[model samples]
Target: MNVPVVTGETTEKHPLEDYLRFDRLPHIWCPGCGLGTVLGAFLRGLLQSGLTPDKVAVVSGIGCTGRSAGYIKLDSFHTTHGRAIAFATGLKLAKPELKVVVFSGDGDLAAIGGNHLIHAGRRNIDLTVLCVNNFNYGMTGGQFGPTTPVAARSTTSRTGNIENPFNMSALAAASGATYVARWTAAQVHQMERSITEALLKRGFSFVEVISPCPTYYGRMNRLPTGLDQMRYYRSNSVVRHGTNPNEVGVGVDGQIVTGKFIDIERPYLPSSGDGNNGG
Candidate 1:
């Protein structure tokens, strides 16, 4: 099925519509892609936070997940591969009033972009990151990504993957994110809550979304459809917070841990710096 793309301007009813470049829609993403659900949660979060599109800047890296910024009605910037966070940092520092968001795939964030991710978390910059962890490099074919499970099958790992995956939320929290949370695409309501809080947060905020890669990850794993892919999260997922990552594992079905694991106040970057300029 072809994805539908609607081009239009922002009206009084859907004011944010103007920020989007709808001509790029009917995105190359596969049908029933979890990215769409993540996008919906993002919009709902913005509405709940009362954020006007003009005041928000959505940045994305290369990958199927990066396509998220294009579908949204906002000041969206599709940046170079693995550089969404770095670009967003500059944008936020230049215009303190605007909310900067980084959207990237698991590989874009955890592997190729790992350095940027850690630095952004360390500085506690005011930016919200929505990482869609599909576990493999879906857009470039089902190749093994850093987030791919140890035993998951991929094009590169015809038998099984041996590399360990990163627990993004925990990594962000330890690195210094003021807000950290994890949720699955199926948990839309909770995901919205996480995004809303992240947007309103003062310091670096990280949200790890467990998105299902049906066409790539699912097919390689022998799942029938995207709906079957969801079963992996529903059955194996413990839905427990603060549990030992080692203790929680995806069984034959797979388990997705979801919840607002952490939140804290931190100094905003704008408030810092030498007082000689204007003050």
Candidate 2:
């Protein structure tokens, strides 16, 4: 075997660099955090969706995942806590031509903004929500939030979380989302495909990404590192593409059932007239 020595540094940029803000090269996410992976998948999906960056709007609430809006090279908005969906809804209604996406953490999307989330699905708003569920409030001292797995330890749940976590895919499907899917950060290709599909879907679409919060969530729960959590996902994930959403609920140290749980068309907003868009 002949070996060729190449010592010159390559200056070629990543294909996705064009979709990001170069000025913000160094993001604040912790080492082993999955936000970057999810963001990359979203950007790739956006490119595959055939939508121009100028006509795409990204909205995010306050959290680790919420910072996505700041890095995307689109019309991005860093909205108030638990208000990303509300803001995205208004943007979508005002400019139906624009592709509005709500990118935020589980705490921001399913807790304080729970009402807005369910209503958005109920009204079948024309928006794609990419919720990064790290299973806790990763940005706020690792407190247990609505999606924290039952019996999982958090800052608040020092011993272990008692309440059952919400099945995000199920909630989206039952609430009337036309497209609903769930994937872990490890499933990058699947995540990107789901995102692209959601973007093309006409009615409300929700994609829940199970990410690793190595800094807080993992530290408190004994995972300690992002790799540990990723390993868990790899070993425990079950991909049932057409499984019923209601049958998939995450529990502490339980099998992670992930896939496209729902895909059905529905009338959106003005057409639905459910009047549930009070957010």
Candidate 3:
């Protein structure tokens, strides 16, 4: 189905519009939310990857990011909370020819779906996982989550969060993901490039995207606007490809190390005869 793209400057339909479900316009994201930016990058990445939209399956769990499934004009699945990876795994196994991608938030992917995330990497599943780390549960009234930076304030952590945040890229690399990368929502080009690279990879691939939840996480942490957070990323983020993922933990108002940290070839489950199958 062809849909016309309506930009302020032009009325011509955009190439990317062919990959979006236009009926879901006026997304549920907040005014300053970065999920929209990330979604744009994803769509552009999909277009650049040269993958057929009908052959791609997007799976999303319950969260702000999970809404991606509903918006993308692909074979998509909106799964239960923290189960997007599991559902994607099934989809991939059932139809090994399909390209399975899981798009969800840090809270859902790292907090509850963490086991599936790690196991997918460990098993060398053929999948691409995009985890948007907003530092808090933006959909659920801005609660602290597994990726919340230490000493960062959230609705639950009024004073500050005491728990250490997970270095998701590091975790993915350590779990045997063949491709691992990290980028901020502000770095649209780099994010899109990384996503394209991950999509082309054969084994388990993971990309951790640091985004802003201006309404909740940002408000609680003093970055009241998305532009403020983007400025922070511009100043604090350092691109160091091949840097040790373990040393890239984000802290409260600290430096954000971003880049393609790991890219290596690994055997998929079927090739290894482990009874697993991946493209």
Question: lDDT of all the models against the reference?
Answer: 0.79, 0.88, 0.89
Q: Measured by TM-score, how close is model 2 to the native structure? A: 0.93
User: For model 2, how does the per-residue alpha-carbon lDDT over 91-113 read when each residue is reduced to its tens digit?
Assistant: 78876767789999898988999
Question: What would the TM-scores of all predictions be?
Answer: 0.87, 0.93, 0.93
Residue 54, model 3, lDDT: 76
**lDDT of candidate 3 over 146-247, digit per residue (tens):** 999888999999999999888899989999999999999989999999999999888899999999899999989889999989899999999999998998
Model number with the top lDDT:
3
Worst 10 residues of 1 by lDDT: 270-279
Model 3 gets an lDDT of 0.89
In terms of lDDT, model 2 sits at 0.88
Superposed on all Cα atoms, the candidates' RMSDs to the truth, in angstroms, are 5.2, 4.6, 3.7
**Candidate 3: worst 10 consecutive residues by lDDT?**
270-279
lDDT over C-alpha atoms for residue 241 of model 1: 63
